[model samples]
Each structure stands twice: as structure tokens, then as C-alpha cells.
Target: MLIHRIFQVVTVIDCVVGMMASGFIVSVGSTDWMRRRKLPACDRILICLCSSRLLLQGTILHATLFPELTQWNVVRGHSVLLVLASTACLWFAACLSVFYCLKIATFTQPCFLLMKLRISAMVPQLLLGSALISLVSSLPFLWVDYSSHLCNSTRSHLKNISFESPTGNNISYFKGFVMYVTWAVVPLLFFIASSTLLIASLWKHIKQMRQNATGFKDSKTEAHITAIKSLISFLMLYICSFIAEILLGIPSCQAMSRWKHNICSLLIAVCPSVHSILLVLLNVRLKLAVKSILLYMKCHRKQDSAEALWQERKSMSSS
Candidate 1:
């Protein structure tokens, strides 16, 4: 019970932080898009990714804060939507990685050149396709037997923090495994392929640049390094989340008694939260926006302090 309470608090804090970060990204991107009257393809993907993350974390927050929401009918619907949001997030990430690779990776293949030329134009279709795939993956929940297998809340100990159980209904281990394979795993594979290609291209470019007599890093090298860092971080966090989700989807695991499975859910909750902040930092536009915001806050605080000090001195002189 104590461990459950602790994990619950941690999960809540993680969700809150994630929501704030995701919200910041959405606000910044929306503001830029509206001001410019145009949206870049990369910005489009990032905004969509953050939006999906917002929905995903919000749903988790709703379930955790309101335990009774996991009762029966509500839980099944929530579970369906939750998985959908997660799948969308995964797909969006894959799209983002692919976009970065195509835009940054130096490739001479005819297919690669063709994709690079058209990737920007294809973003909208890619996003739509990802959403459709997620919808398809989620359809199984609606088809499953919710009356008996899913609605049985009696088996749940911790308001059923995990979506599925062993009975294989609205929620089962076998179904969860299948969904992960069909939905999450596919995007992960795509992401890996793109990231690998990007890395190889970056390495080759760096080696060529180093061969120059100067032997000094230039803007291109720095850009390559940054891209590699961003891609590596994304890969690491995504893999952590993938593993965590598989643990949470297990049916037989008791969240209360089995800290392993329970903690994995917490990991899943934390991933988006942590990664949202990371994305903001690694992105040039987002990073600049954050710096300006921080500067403004600092100046505002100083102005407030100066005003308070003036008022205090005036009062003293009057006295």
C-alpha cells in the first residue's frame, strides 16, 4: 500500500510535468504558425507529436487521479482511447525521425533523393496515415468482449492501473502483445532504420570535413553532432517507453504486489514528460523561444524587485 501510494504520487507528478511541457510546445508552435501564416513540415510534426503526448498524459492523469474511473464501462473506452493516443505518439515520432533523416542525411541513392525532395510535401499525408493506423490498431478494443473479460473490475487491486489483464477482452495480455507488435513496434522499426541511415551519413560527412587542412569543426559538423544527439536521445527514450509499455500491458501482473510491472507504468508515464523537455532543448526554434521566455521572466522579476524597493524607501522617508 505504501509503495502504491508512492508510485501513484510519482506518476501524478510525472504527468503534471509532461502536461506542462507538452502544453508549452503546443503554445509556442501555434503562436509561430499563426504569426507566420505558414507552418514548416518539421514544426507540423512536432506540434502533432506534442498534441498526442498531451492527450496521452491527460488520459493517464484522469485514470490515476480518479480510481473509480477504472470501474467497468468507463475503463474500456478510456483504455481504447489511451492506446490510440499512444500509438499516434509512436507514429508521430517515427515520422519526425524520418523527416530529420531525409532532410539532414546526405544520401545519393535515387530513392533517397526522391524522398528528400518530397518529404516536406508528404508530411500531412504521413500524419493522416499515422492516425488511420492508430485507429485501426485501436479498433480491436471495441471488438473485444467487454461484458465479461474487460468489465470484471473485481480482479483489479489498484483500480486496474494497467489496461489489460490475463483473461485476453477489452484488456488482455495477449491482445496487448499483439497491439504493440502491430502498432508500436512498426514505428519503432521505422525510427531505427531512419536513425541508422542518418547516423551513417553524418559520420561520413564528418570524416570528409576532418580531412580538410583546418581540422576544425564548422557549422555543418556542429549541426551533424546536434542532430545525432537529438536522434540518440529520442531513440533511447522511445526504447525505454516501448519496454515499459510491454510490462504495463501484462495481464497477470498485480500492480500493488508486483512493483516491477507497476514501476513500468510509471516509466511509461515519465517518458513523454522527460522527452517533451528534451525535444524543446534540442530543437533550435524551441530552444530560442525558451531562452527568450526565460530572459523576459528574469527582467520582469528584476523590475518587480526594484519597484518594491522604491516603495519601501519612499515609506521610510515619509516616516
Candidate 2:
């Protein structure tokens, strides 16, 4: 019981931090859009990605931390909605990866050049298409008979398990498998493909620069390194999240100790939030914005302390 409580506290902290980072992205992007009356393509994508992640993290916290409240039929019916938010977050992040690859990678091929030229114009359309795809993919979940397999052997052993059984009827299993593949596996493939291409392009560029006697101590080289690091970090987190999700769905995992289940849930919740913080760190403008906000808060705090001290001194003298 103590271990379970510790895990729950850790999960809550992870969710809170993730929500704050994602919320920062949304706030900064929206503020910029409002001031300029237009948002860059990348900022637009960031906004969508952060918004989706925020919603996803919020729902995950509510569902995980308070399973009893979510057990109502009406709340359970909205399982598809949670799936929709998660799908959107995954697709948007994948889209952002592709956007970075197209924008930053230098490819001399006509097709690659053409895509680089047109990607800005295509961002809105791509986002819309992703949204439509997420919606379509999630809709099938609504038709899934969640109540049909309530007495499944795996779930019977678990306390407060929310996911429907994927080992039930042949039809339900097939649908669940399809949904899992489309929602999780496909987006991961896209992210991996984009990250690979970006890394290859950056490596080739770095090599050519090195051959030209330009040592690798320049801003562009540093940027390339940062981007590569960011991609690697995101991939690592995504893999962890993927494995956790898979394990959570397994019957064996359902029978695990409460602390083990809590740890799995914590990993699942960490992915979106941590990835958003990485995004902020990798992006120059976002990094600057976060720094500025922190500096402002620090200065304000000092000013408040100074004022309090002055008031105390003045009161002591008068007395």
C-alpha cells in the first residue's frame, strides 16, 4: 500500500509537469498568434500538438488517478473521446517530425526540393488531414461493445482496469487489434521514418562541411546536433510509452501487483509531457520564451521580498 501511494504521487507529479509544459506551448503560441495576427506554420503545428497533449494528459490523470469516478457508464462511454485525444497527440507529433525533416534537411533531389518548397503551404492541409484520420480511426472504438466482456478472466483479477479486453470474441479482438495498430504502430512508424531521414540528411551535411575544411564548431552544426539529440530523446520516450501501452493491454500485466501497474501507468503518462518539454528546449524561440518567463518570475519574487523587508524595517523604526 505504501509503495502504491508513492507511485501515485510520482504519477501525479509527472502529469502536473507535463500539463505545465504543454500549457506553456499553447499559451506562447496563442499569444504570438494574437499579437502578429498570423502564426508561422511551425507555430501552428506546435499549438495543435501542445493542445492535443494537454487534453490527453488531463484525461489520463483523471482516468488513472480516479478510476472510481470514471466507472460510470456515461464516463465509460467517452473512452473513444480519450482515444481521439491520444490519437491526435500522436499524429500531430508525427506531423511535427515530418515538418522538421522537410524544413531542415537539405536534399538536392527535385522531389525533395519540391516538397521543401511546398511544405509551408501544405501544413494546414496536412493538419486537417491528420485530424480527419484520427477521427476516423477513433470512431470504430465507439462501436466496440465495452460491456460485452466484463467478465473476462484477465479483468476479473485486476482492480479498476479500464481498457476493454482484446482477447474476447474474434470480432472484438480483430477490431481492437486494428485500432491498436492504426492508433499506435502506424504513427510510430511515421515518426521513426522522419527522424531517420532527418538524421541522415544532417550527417551528410556535416560531412560535406567537414570536407570543406569547415570544422564543426558553427551555429548550424550545433543546431543539427541539437535536433538529432531531440529526435533521439523523443524516440526513446516513444518506445517506452509504446511498450507500456502494450504491457497494459496484456492479460499477464493485468494480474500484476498494484505497484507494478502504477509504474506502467506512470511511464504511459510521462511520454507526452516530457516530449513537449523537449520540443521547447529544441526550438530556439520557445526556449527563449520560457527563459524570459522564468527571469521575470525571479525578478518579481526578489522585488516582493525586498519590499517586505523594507516594510518590516520601517515598522520597527517607528515602534
Candidate 3:
């Protein structure tokens, strides 16, 4: 019981931090859009990614963390919606990875150059296409009978029992496989491929610079390195989250202690928020915005403290 409580507290903290980081991305991007009356392609993608993640995290919190507040019927009915939102979040993150690879990685191939030239114009369309694909892929879950079963299984071990009908069981397993492939495997492949190409491009650039005796210390090189590091870190976190999601589906894991289950849920929930923070750190504009906000808050706090101290001193003198 104590462990469960501790995990609950940890999950709440993770959710709050993750939501705040994603919210920051949305606010910053929206502000930029308002100022320019049009956002850059990257900022537009960031806004979509952040908004999806924010909604995903909120839904996860309500569905997993505060299950009592949500009736079983509501949870069952909205399970498809939750999956759709999460799918959108994952797809958008993958889209962002692809966007970065296209924008930052240099290639000598004509196709690559053409893509680089056209990527900015293509981003909005790409995002729309991704959303449409995610929706279409997720629509099957709505028709699949096993969604309610999965939802109930998450809440209790009773629903994890085998179905009497082998045909139903087979169909459920098939649907599960399809969902895993579409939601996890597809995005992972895209992320891995993009990361590999980006790394190779950066490596080649570094080697050429070294041959030219330019060294590898320029701002551009540093930016490339930072991007590579961020991508690698996000990939690692993504893999962990993917594994956690898989494990959570297993009956044995669901039968475990509540704390153990909560731990897996926490792992899955934190990925988007943590990745957004990494994005902010890697992007100069976003980082500056976060820093400015922090500095303003610090100054405001100091001013409030100073005013309180002055009032105390004045009251003492009058007394």
C-alpha cells in the first residue's frame, strides 16, 4: 500500500512536469505564430506535437491515475479515443524526427537536395497526412471487440482470462498484433532510419571538415552534434516506453502489484514530456523563451520578497 502511494505521487509529479513542458512548447509556438502571423514549418510541427502530447498525458492521467473518477463504461467507450490520441502523439513525434533529418542533414544526392529545398513547403502537408493516417489506422480499434476487454483487463485481472471461443481469441490476438505493428513498429522504423541518415550525414560532414583542416568546432557542427545527441537520447527513451507499453499488455504484468503496474504506466507517460524538454534544450529560440520566463519569475519573486520586508520594517518603526 505504501509503495502504491509512493508510485502514485511519483506519477503525479511526472505528469505535472511533462504537461508543463509540453504546454510551454504550445505557448511559445503560438506566441511566435501570433507575432509573425505565420509560424515556421518547424514551429508548426512543434505546436502540433506538443498539443497532442498534452492531451495524451491528460487522458492517461484521468484514465490510469484516477480511474475511480471515470466509470467503467466511460473508460470502455473512450479507450479507442485514448489510443487514437496516443497514436497521434507518437506519429507527430516521428514526423518531427523526420523533419529534423531533412532540415539539418546535408546530402550530395540530387534527390536529397531537392527534398531539402522542398521540405519547408511540404511540412504542413506532411503533418496533415500523418494525422489522417493515424486516424485511419486507429479507426480499426473502434470496431475491434477486444478494446473493451483490454480496458477491463487493465483495471482488473479477471478480464485477462481466456475467451471460451478460440476464434474470438484469435481475432483479439490479431488485432493486438496489428495495433503493435502500426503504433510501435512503424514509427520506430521511421525514427531509426531518419536518425541513421542524419548521423551519417553529420559524420561525413565532420570528416570533410577535418580533411580541410577546419576542425569540427564551428557553430554548425556543434548544432549537428547537439541534434544527434538529442535524437539518440529520445530514441532510447522511446524504446523503453515502447517496451513498457508491450509489457503492460501482458496478463502477467497486469496481475502484478499495483505499484509495479503504476511504474510501467509512468514510464509510458513520461516519454512525450521528457522529449519535449529535450526539444526545448536543443532549439535556441525555445530555450531562450524558457530562460526568459524563468528569469522573469525569479525577479518577480525577489520584488515580492523585498516589498514584504519593507512593509515589515515600516510597521515596526511606526509601532
Candidate 4:
């Protein structure tokens, strides 16, 4: 048990760091040339999506490491905030998937205009889906507030919960199951389906390039193709992690196995962490942007030091 808890803690830390890094990359990358004014909607969507990931990971980390500390008022408040953030992230991912499908599969003559006008349509769906999932996941906590010291859903003592209404436990469990289905299972299936189509499209595209190497050797097309492939690989990992989570969630399996929860949590953490690694590799522009930021910071520090020395000299002369 101690070993398992240690593994869970390590995995949670990895996931939190990965999510934060990915969010920063996405946030910074969005301001670069990859997203022009014409594509600002997509930028906004991606930024929100990445930001949600950070929040979700933060919640999970707190649940895993600081369950006891949650007894504090601030921890309790943060727990609720993390849950909301996770639900919002799920909704955003769903919207992103659907948006890609529309752009790739059903490109109409006025698709850009339609995208611009109907982008707002996705906001309500995201809001509604997130709210429903949050309500479901959090319903169980209503019956028991464990002083925020234990990880989320870490406690097994049902009797200590003082506010157990007759149906609350059942409702809570049901809500949790629903969130597992909606956020993890359903989206996973969608990712698999969409990714399958993307892979097929990429295969056909590559075949065409092979047959007409001279005509299709444009650098932009090659780069776009590579980006698509990277995205599909990331989606595949997401699907695998989700499937692992679903398998671990089986009632019989969880009941029979003491280590199931930690194992599943570790598997789930692998997705975002692996994704962070890939984003660093695939996004050349992001890599350069980070280098530039570091360079700028170094130069700014030197300038600050120079200014301080000049200020001292002027002050001494004035005296």
C-alpha cells in the first residue's frame, strides 16, 4: 500500500508538471504566427482547452497528496474549483474534436464564415456539459466533508459522513459513474473514431505525395502533414489512457483489487504527461519561442543590473 501510494504521488506530480508546461506552451504558442487574426477563434479554443488541463491536474494532485489538508476552508474551496476546471476542460476537448471534424470532413463554401458565426454555438454546449459533469462528480462529497485532509475519493469510511440523506450515497456514486462515462469513456470513443479518420486521410495524403513527389513536395504541406500525424498520435494516447481508466473502474475489478485505484490513476496521468513531451517535440515554433523568452529574460536581467549601477553612481554624485 505504501509503495502504491508513493507511485500515485509520483505520477500525480508528473501529471501536474506536464499539464502546467503544456498550458504555458499552448498559451505562448497561440500568440505566435500559427494563429493569425483569422484563426483567433481556434486560438481562444485551444488556450481554454490547455488551461482547463492545468486546473484538472491541480485538482487531482490535491486529491492525491493533500487530502488531509483539504479540511481547511481554502482547500475545500480549491477542490470545488478544480472539479469545475476539469469539467470545463472535458467540454472544451469535445468541442475541439468536433471543430476539427467540421474543418476536415465537411468544408462548405462558406465554412470560414460559418465557423466565425457559429463558434459561439459551442460555448453553451461546453458550459452545459461541464456543469452537468461537475454536479455529478461532486454530489458524493456533499454527504461527507473529510476536513479536506484526504485525497479526493480516498476515504472509505461511510459512517463518519454526518449528512447522509437516504438517497445521497446512491446519487453520489451514480453521478461519479456518469462523469467517468461522459468525460473519460465517451470522449475517448470519439477520439478513437476521429483519429482513425485522420490516420486514413494522412495515409492517402502520403500515398499521393509518393506518387507525385515533385508536385507535392511543398514544405508547408509536409509540415502540416507532420502536425496532423502528431495530433493523431496524441489522441491515440488519450484513448489508451481512457480505456485503461474504464477497465480499472469496473466494480468487480475495483472491489477485488486493492491497488486498482492507484494503478488507474497512474495510467490516467500518463496521457497528459506523454502529451507534454510530444508537444515539446512536435511544435518547433514553440521551442524557438521558449528559447527566445529565455534569451530575453537574460538580457533583461543584465540591463536591470546596468541600470542599478548607473543609478548608484548618479546618487553618489548628487550627494
lDDT of each: 0.82, 0.77, 0.75, 0.60
lDDT of 2 by residue, 1-319 (tens): 6877787788888889999999998999999999999999989988998888777778777776775553435444456666778778778878888988998888789998999999999999989988998878777665554543332334462223664444342335346645756577888899999999999999998888788865447787788888889888988887888787666544343334465567778998888788888888888899999889899999999999999999999999999
Candidate 4 lDDT over 163-224, as tens digits, reads 22343333343354455466545655655665565556567766766888885466745665
Per-residue lDDT of 1-319 in model 1, one digit per residue for the tens? 7887888899999999999999999999999899999999998998999999999999888877886554446766777888889999999999999999999999999999999999999999999999899888887776453333232335543434443333444454466557656678889999999999999999899788867749565887788898899889889999999888766665553532347745887888898888899888888888899899999999999999999999999999999
Candidate number achieving the greatest lDDT relative to the actual structure: 1
- Rank list by TM-score: 1, 2, 3, 4
Tens digits of per-residue lDDT, candidate 3, 1-319, equal 6877777777778878899999998998898889889988888888998888787788777765665543334643455666666777777768878888998998778988888899899988889987887777666654444533443334653343532222242345346545756565787788888988999999998897888875347888888999899888888887888777666655343434465578788897878778888888888998899789899999999999999999999999999
Which residue pairs of candidate 2 clash? none
Q: Return the TM-score for candidate 1, rounded to 2 decimals.
A: 0.87
Q: After superposing candidate 1, which stretches have Cα over 4 Å from the reference? A: 146-173, 253-257, 316-319
Residue 220, candidate 3: alpha-carbon lDDT: 86
All predictions: root-mean-square deviation over Cα?
3.9, 3.8, 4.1, 6.1
Q: Model 3 clash pairs?
A: none
State how far residue 132 of model 4 sits from its true place (Å): 6.9
Error of 3 at 141 (Å): 2.8
Q: What C-alpha lDDT, on a 0 to 100 scale, does residue 168 get in candidate 3? A: 42
The lDDT of model 1 is 0.82
